[model samples]
Target: MVVDLVVIGTAITLGPLHNSAFILLLTAERGVRRGLVFILSWLAGLLMVIAAVILLTGGTPPARQSVPSTAALAGKLALGLGLVAYGERKRRRPPRPRHAPKWMERPDRVSGWTAAGLAILLQPWAMVGAGAATAVDANLSSIASTLALTGFCVLATSSMLAMELYTTFSPVAAEAKLRGLRDWLDTHQDQAIVSLSLLLGLWLVADSIYQLVE
Candidate 1:
């Protein structure tokens, strides 16, 4: 449960492409419905990862040197190295303006199923994997672990959740504000991804190594 808290903290902090995508989805025709579907899909993906960890560990946190722990640590290391490599690759690319994806341009015609699929597709798999790794330490058999994991899910969805409430409350005013936000998100998306991947990736790699060696 404790490690799960750290995972929640990290999950809440990472601002990925999904943030912008969520906003854009809200700006579309049938925006609310699509946005809700997207969010549910996103949450489901996170839950699926957690479920896998639970099944693997049987609701028990593994010892530092236990097989399950070592496997989880290895998973973290692989994800970290992959993200770091990805970030480095993106960083070395020539400086050029990045454009919004075609899906982002006109969310109006996007079907609900597409929006749902987009959530899963665009989910930060590496980061989510890291969370899943940490969740290996959560004892799902305990009520506390259940609560903590539930909390993690809510925190992970915090940003988009806020936007949904905002749009529902103030539709007209929200559009102008979200449009501006959406544009900034588009322009900076790549840089943001690179920075996050590099930073968190390094942290995950270091922590995994420490756990494996210490």
Candidate 2:
């Protein structure tokens, strides 16, 4: 039970950060209300993913032995290259002035429930991790343990929320801290995200190749 909770918590933390949808949603909104909504939606998506994975894998957690083949390696590499190229293309594009949405423009009118739902539905990674966890623990029947797992997920995600809150409430201070990092990223944005993509892709490719060879 402890192991399961730890695994679930770690999955939630890592999944949401890298999940494209989660990042996009977080970037699109401003303030704690939006952040809360994103968290709700993220959790919802995660639950759904867990359900699906459980169904597909017959309630079995994906074992390391289930890794893909060499051909899969080539595919992962191609996918990684494609992602890097896309990031480069985006970097080259000029930033358009952001237009505030009607609701966002009227901050007082925003609905927390709606924000939470939308954020969760938009992200895919949350769903994947949740699904995987659900699959792994399909037979586990400890309600208290399950609740503990959920609590850990919420706690893990709080890190992102805390960061957002800090930036929103203390813009001057946040900006000061971020200034150097932002400048560095601006100067090497393409290379940075691309390099990250490549590294992740290579890791995936190598793993797949190893699985196939074994």
Candidate 3:
């Protein structure tokens, strides 16, 4: 369970697509306000997926001796295989320059609400789903498991929260350093995604298979 949590948290933190977007928001006019919105929205987005899954599963696992959790495991497996294929395909393709979305370009005009919306929109849904699925095995009926999920959220959101606080407390002083960070994230974004997807996808698929067979 701890291993799964670490993998999921790392994947969410290192995800380049949305993290880069937040970095841009932080660099905007009224960036402190915008960055706060982005952080809350991002955290909520992560929690919502897990909440939905818990509701669906009723927060209870079937008896181990009953049928293996075949359906759920299979679903995870399919998602994993898809991510692996996706990462491999991207690896084979030539890299192309990506243009920032027009909305991203006009960061100065970005409002809190817009930043919030971007957080929800830019979620890596596949990775979120995997985390939720991994968490299913946690017996959330206990306070300990509930706390564990909370910890997962904290760990996953750590990177963004760190950046938000840094930029907020020292916006002028942080600007140059933050921009350098942003540039590096943008440059390595695709490779980061590919690596994360492959690593976590493979883990999810293997774990799912083990659960099903047990």
Per-residue lDDT of model 2, residues 1-214, tens digit only = 3443454354335432223233333344354456656676666665665555446655443454344223323444455445445556656767655453465444444466766755654443422333243335343365664565466556546545655676678766754554454445445644555454444434434543554467
TM-score leaderboard ranking: 3, 1, 2
Once fitted onto the true fold, the runs of candidate 1 whose alpha carbons sit more than 4 angstroms away are 1-13, 96-101
Model 3 poorest 10 in a row by lDDT: 61-70
Residues 45-68 of candidate 3: C-alpha lDDT, one tens digit per residue: 888887887887688765553443
**Structure candidate 2, residue pairs in collision:** 37-116, 41-120, 42-120, 49-127, 49-131, 50-130, 50-131
RMSD of each: 2.1, 7.4, 1.7
Name the better of 1 and 3 by TM-score: 3
The residue ranges of model 3 lying beyond 4 angstroms of the native Cα positions read: 65-68
Q: What is the TM-score (0 to 1) of candidate 2?
A: 0.49
Give the TM-score of each candidate.
0.90, 0.49, 0.93
Per residue, candidate 1 scores C-alpha lDDT tens digits across 13-35 of 45758888888889888798898
**lDDT for predicted candidate 3 compared with the true structure:** 0.82
Predicted structure 1: lDDT:
0.82
